[model samples]
Target: MTLEIVVHRPSVSGGGRRVTVGGVDFGLARGDGDLVEFLRRAGLDDADQLVSGDSPIIQWRGGRAHEYGAAGG
Candidate 1:
């Protein structure tokens, strides 16, 4: 199945990135750990595999992987 998960740009306040799966908002994630958990809770058992590299399942907007700091935004 193809899932469109978007990790939106980090806010200037540095709260965290907003995670959305298939247009539904899950929550904010500060790091990969939270991202993995959110994906798992969303019914993806292979969340780990999808969270790394250029999986094409995730659209990292306004930043790339490993970048979620407010100071950089």
Candidate 2:
């Protein structure tokens, strides 16, 4: 089964992007580290690689990888 991971736009408050797996909300991630943990918990052992590189499994919305601009930005 393909995991539909979506990194939503960063929030204006804390600049944390919401992460969802297969349409399930995994909470907000402030950075790649938070995203990696969420992915690992979701059973993706290669979470590190997946979060680091450009992988189609992850559909980033609003912003690209690691581009969570400052809340003031």
Candidate 3:
């Protein structure tokens, strides 16, 4: 299983590269380690369960879809 990390930068006001995980949106200033830690804390490190077709536990929060688990795990 492989984890895909996508970095997005918007060309608009208040637009910047951010990492969203488990319904939480974090700025790039937070650092990569922080992002990884956030994912780990969200039970996303379980590669077995993630790759078993039960991945991307999705939940609606703040009018957006927050996905958990590994991508293509």
lDDT of each: 0.85, 0.86, 0.39
Model 3 per-residue lDDT tens digits across residues 1-73 = 4444333333233322355554365444133344445456545775344333435542222222223222222
Question: Of the candidates numbered 1 and 3, which has the greater lDDT value?
Answer: 1
Quick one: how many clashes does candidate 3 have?
0
Q: What are the per-model C-alpha RMSD values against the true structure? A: 1.5, 1.7, 10.8
Ranked candidates, highest TM-score first: 1, 2, 3
lDDT by residue for model 2 (1-73), tens: 7989999987887669999998889888988999999999899999999988878889888766787664446
List, residue by residue over 1-73, the lDDT tens digit for candidate 1.
6878899998789988999998889999999989999899889899988886557878889986757788485
Leading candidate by lDDT: 2
Please provide TM-scores, in order, for all candidate models, with all chains considered together: 0.88, 0.87, 0.30
Backbone clashes under 3 angstroms, per model: 0, 0, 0
Once superposed on the true structure, which residue ranges of model 2 sit more than 4 Å away at CA?
A: 70-72
Pairs with steric clashes in candidate 3: none
Question: Which residue pairs show collisions in model 2?
Answer: none
